[model samples]
Target chain A: MAVQITTQEAVKKIRDKSSVMIGGFLGAAVPLKMIDEIATAGIKELTVISIGAGYRGGGVDIGKLVLNKQISKYVTSHVGTDPNLIKQIVNQEVELELSPMGTFVERIRAGGAGLGAVVTPVGMGTEVEEMAEKIIVDDKPYLLFKPIRADVAVIKAHRCDPLGNLQYKGMSNTSPVMATAADIVIVEVDEIVEVGAIACENIGTPGIFVDYIVKGHSYQERKNVYEELWIATNKL
Target chain B: MSRDYIAKRIAKEFRDGMYVNLGIGIPTESANYIPAGTEVFLQTENGGLMFGPKPERGESDPDLANAGAEPITMLPGGAVFDVATSFAMIRGGHIDMTVVGALEVDQAGSIASWKIPGKLLTGMGGAMDLLYGCKRVIVAMTHTDKHGNSKIRKRCTLPLTAAAVVDMIITDKAVFRVAEDGLYLEELAAAVTVAEIERLTEATIMNIGEWQESEMS
Candidate 1:
């Protein structure tokens, strides 16, 4: 029951200054073509919610948006890889919120599950404790992280069926939870097949949560991009 | 007092079939010292579990990597899961032990590793979560900072990762275990006298006479 759409059309669902949940860790399993389209469409003031910085180098995947200054705020666990993003944060050109990695993902999951809040002791006495409300249950203190839901979610999958069931080839990263926590879920996939092609056990993101499917860059294209990045960044 | 030596000492504590998480820095080197064919599973917070050794250059798979983004190979029975599930295993207390590096550790066994004031850092990836839920928390660090400041303090001057959560400390100088009695010296590194570590340590080093330098080499 998901509509197949072009990357351009899919990115059009995102509005300026809206929050977007982008799936991936350090550029792995990211919707490259969709992110590229969003950057090209000149979307401004987007609040990007991700786990970490985009790829090792500074001009691919999410890094492109940072380079373009497309992001007004970044809510992620870390941002050391991309120098441009760090510079923007240091210059106050971008507002940055850092969360503990596990807590960030749990908040998103809580949103998807329609939970009120996530209680955990991970940030009990750190800088993160200052930002969250603390609750004590049975003489134990726990930091309460509110659920996070985004206006739109752009995620990448290894493959998908016409019904929008997704399968991830490698690291799923933040895609599955983002798919559920967003008001609109747009998926970028390497291949599309019939509804029954992906087995039930293999389905990662079920069709119930997906709204649109976009054909992403081909394997060869993605490989070339990573290869070029590897050379340029000297990432062993 | 070497990193490898510290890692080897921590590796000895690993039992077969234990699910262990290793933090970046000195804890990552413990991978090299894990006993061969021990069936110990290494869980990287980035979503990899039971991965093989760090891959050689040019043979690295960028996608198959540790939390540190270093390329690694997957073992035969090893599998990769999503980040959510990875944290579930960590936060759910399914991980048996986690070894981490510390910037400061207080007498209360509190750990401060993530940040240093006025310095920019990437942020804590999964260190706090690991410490929050793992069955045992082992800190592997040098006894002193590069400037000769004792990392073992009576109280942490920096921020805290967790309070009274560290179960053990394995420094280059000695091994200390936290208990109701405070920081108890459990073992001393080879050729290191109790007086030598006492001078470098700011916290009260207790039960040194009861501790033995049994396994240190």
Candidate 2:
């Protein structure tokens, strides 16, 4: 059934201390509005798992979460620009599990596929091999990266049909696999059309993975009385 | 004669027809020193790029790139591919050499190349994958900052990029190959003496290779 809900309602399904797998490499397909809503909703002690965008890509990293203080733990491959989370982890205020970048992507792929584990040649001797379960094969030990299951997967889509079939531009697949892996997949698209309007070949993610679709809220139009002061001050 | 003594150390490793991946920051500078007429191919991690020397002004391909997300142009014979395939070249041990920037190198030759506690630098680009998966890795860097802290240290306190993947260390002072036992200092500039390096380093470094002055200007 198609669900019509606010971003806060979707985040409400995620309780405190839940191990939620988020989809994003950076801001590329990262659900920022949902993350912002979750941050504002007052949930705490949540663990987020995801990747990085080199510079200005993913907003899913700890910057916004640290600003909102919503994330308690992070199991991610890269948290590049967010210094607060790194400081918190260094200070032991937040728990962190840093994985290899490629392996982090594969971990999500394995999780959504329901595989118990997948073997890889990555992180054999490095710090990433120090997972919860470490095993050896052929006299060489391999760490067991368990399946990642999320309570909700918040994603960004370029376009969505009424039935929720999604389309994406090329090279925008940070959380594409996770889009189908989560229990509740909430997508925010720029535009929506009627069912059967989208070509089947272009429907990268099927409608079944989708539970709800919402157009993103636009804050571009809002003007403040102290807009210049606010803009300059906030720029800091 | 200059701080660019590090460049000559990296330049020595270049070979004809070598497929190389350059990391962000100073590692990218190695591209400027590749001997002319050498068929060295450059590969980036994000999306597409072709291998070549830098393109002419106003003729560079904007789509060509490295992991740093810089706008790059492909050469005449460059091939474009996806990150999945490019990383395959890295992970599958296809690339000949990979040069990355490092934050710290411990006595054990372990590297902590990513994440500074007080800095806003975001993300480790292809360094981990390239390091573990590459056949060999060269860390190109400034030996020490103006503050006089030896980046080659007892142990790294910052977050690690890869524990022990570096093959050679190229600093402005000298070029040292990291071995399982200890560091093997290969070459040094005339301005910076061996005594200065020994006094600076906290680890036990050995002189393994003969001294050779760099030929690059």
Candidate 3:
């Protein structure tokens, strides 16, 4: 059973200096309304865990937090798209911990699955090797990355039933894993349907993992939002 | 040679039925030049597989996007999954080849594309994993920087993306293959001479094989 809440109420659950996981890749599947609420709430010193920075050029979605100086630390795989975030990191305002995209997601999955750590050969001979502990098994070298768990996770989905069974339309990105790796999971969805509306096979995130649900903009509205931003940014 | 010419040359390396991942910038443009008869599936780290070309302006879907955050279309047989599964496909060695843009490439096939230390804060997105997992790693880039300094170096001064992972280098001027022994020159763009290459490239060319002129008019 999940409680339906407003975006304002959802942001209230996140405290300053909390470890938060935001699910999205660039800008595709972000919880925009919740992020907006968080930005408005002026939460500071957050440890934001995400796969990458928000859309190219910044000042959109998660980039809003960067502009607000809300995040104290960013745990992510890529930040090339957001110049604002880059500038902050360069100025020593935001601490950055980076890993390969694959390894970043795997660490989250490992956290959700209760694994100790993940051993990978992906960063064996690069700067990534300096970030993690190196281990040798059978004469082959691998890097050991610890699991990542967050205080709260905000994710976006296409639809959800009253019971909070989520169904994603396209590109689930990091939501599903982030949903499982958080203490409190707040999901923003386009629509809320009847209890049995979402078929079991179609459920992307089960109600067991979701704590709260917030109704967000519909598919068309989100499309228009991105279209406007893209046009403004000369990306369209 | 233009960036399109570098991408076109890189596209020639693809084989039919290959599952390829293209990095941002010029490597992403190589998708448009994939061979006509070839059946290549494009994988974006963002979670979509077998994605097609960019969507028309008004026809774009908010949920459908490439790794670069640009609107994209999925092919008829395409599928979408979560990020964990997407990276599993990458790290599991399911991707056949990956084409990525590089800032510098050393003679030992090591690449430095992710960071420029204190200057550029661009983090390594998935380049290290792609180089470590993909069956083949092809670097698509210009031969020199805007200042005419060679990017092909004896040693990369910047932080490396991965060491000894590049299988091929397709630049605006030449093509080189990395082997266990050393780097070998395989092809040259038209009107480009060996003397020019020697002056432009900083790394030692171990061997000059039979030079095949690139099909660039």
Candidate 4:
């Protein structure tokens, strides 16, 4: 069973420099409130791994984090649409470690599974391989990609029972495996109900994967409150 | 010389089997003359490759795109791959060449590939990776804007893509190679005179004497 916590408590639990995997690709089905909490906490040097979708978050989701100066480095797939990331990287304002989207997912999954490393042909003879270690297997050289792990996982869910069973409502998912790998799995949901209220089978991630549940605050009149969050966070 | 003339001249530097990443605008036009069957592979930072010709209307694949976020069809022998890996290829030093346009280039070969002084722009797409990754870089642009300010200057006053990665400069006025010695003039557009080209240039350019005419495919 998971404890029911307010959004602030959920945010408070995450320490500084903690690695967090925030869900959603291109902003769909993302955990806006939890992200807001993390941004507001003024956590320094936190590593955020996500698909760059500041545009769909009504702007890039992590761009606000970058703008707010909450995060120090990023392990992301794309930041093309995010103007702030572009400017920062161009200006050398932040440290960015970029990986391919598929490779990024594989790294998260491989980390959770306790795999030491995976061989990929994606970055061969390229700059990504410049950081790579080459190994010979059967007389052919292969690039060994390292495993990635997170300290905390901030995940979004459509519904969560008191037991912490979760249901994801969206087209696709990103960095879900980091939930199982991280030490603390904090879940933010649109709605929270009783245990067993959600069908046992429909839950995408079982309750065992979650450590805490924070319910999302809905403001009917002030739509897209997440956008206002950056303005507030930047003041901090 | 002009931007198109420079682009056509820069197209001559393409060598066989060179792994290349092209930037947007006039530099993207160099795809038209990739040595017919040079075995060159084009990478776009956004996702896919359109290494060959601009496909006919219906022949394009909506899913396959260039670094510029435009729809494209791959050249023959092209394969589909993930975007991150594509960039890894760029960042990993797998590319042999990068040909892109420049907003500004200083005498020392420092480049500005992103942001016009006052306007918000689309920004760099693999330009940083291409700048630092590829072994050879060629910039294609006119000698000056229609407004007549040098794109080639003493220093780049704009947001630079990467430090100093330029190996060659192909301007509408002439073809200049960035040698250890200096900017050496290799070829000239027929209409432009060597003395006129030298007067307009910002740096001490080497007139490697004259070379052949350029035909942009």
Candidate 4 positional error at B67, Å: 1.5
Off by over 4 Å in 4: A1-236, B1-3, B47-62, B116-125, B206-217
Question: lDDT by residue for model 1 over A53-166, one digit each (tens)?
Answer: 887656678999998899999998888778789888878999988778899999999999999998888888777889799999999998998999999999888889988899
Summing lDDT over every window of 10 consecutive residues in candidate 2 chain B, give the lowest-scoring window. B208-217
lDDT of 2 by residue, A1-236 (tens): 34656776677777888766665444333455677777777788887766653123223333666656667777766666465666676677777766666666666777777788856666665555566467779987667877666777777666788787887533334446777567877886656778888899978678878888877533221112112222332311
Docking class of 3: medium
Error of 3 at B64 (Å): 0.3
lDDT of 4 by residue, A86-154 (tens): 676667665677654445656777787789886655444334566567877888766677877787888
In model 4 chain A, the worst 10-residue window by lDDT is A227-236
Once fitted onto the true fold, the runs of candidate 1 whose alpha carbons sit more than 4 angstroms away are A56-60, A227-235, B55-63, B209-217
lDDT of 1 at A139: 98
* Residue A186, model 3: Cα distance from true site in angstroms: 0.2
Which structure is stronger by TM-score: 1 or 2? 1
- Evaluate chain B of model 2: give its TM-score: 0.85
> In model 3, which runs have C-alpha deviations exceeding 4 angstroms?
B209-217
After superposition, candidate 2 runs with Cα above 4 Å error: A1-19, A52-62, A90-93, A193-203, A217-236, B1-21, B29-90, B94-96, B106-109, B114-126, B145-164, B178-187, B193-217
**What's model 3's lDDT at A148?**
94
Best by DockQ: 3
* Root-mean-square deviation per candidate: 2.9, 6.5, 2.4, 10.3
Q: Write the per-residue lDDT of candidate 1 for residues B1-217, one digit (tens) a residue.
A: 4888898999888899999999887888887888887778999887888898855555655457667555578988888888989999999999999999999999998989877766756567677888988999999999999999999999998888788889999988889899877999887798988778878999987775554343233
By DockQ, the better pick of 1 and 3 is 3
Writing each residue's lDDT as its tens digit, candidate 4 over B1-217 gives: 2555655665677778777777776777766756676766776654454355544544443234344333356677765444345656766687788888787886667787655644644424345556766778888887887687777776777766655668888877777777665677777678777667756876765443432122221
lDDT of 3 at B136: 94
Ranking by DockQ: 3, 1, 2, 4
lDDT (tens digit, per residue) of candidate 3 on B1-217: 3888988898899899999999988998888898899989999988999998877789888889888778888999999999888888888999999999899998899999988866787889988888888999999899999999999999888989999999999999999998887788888898888778878999988864233233322
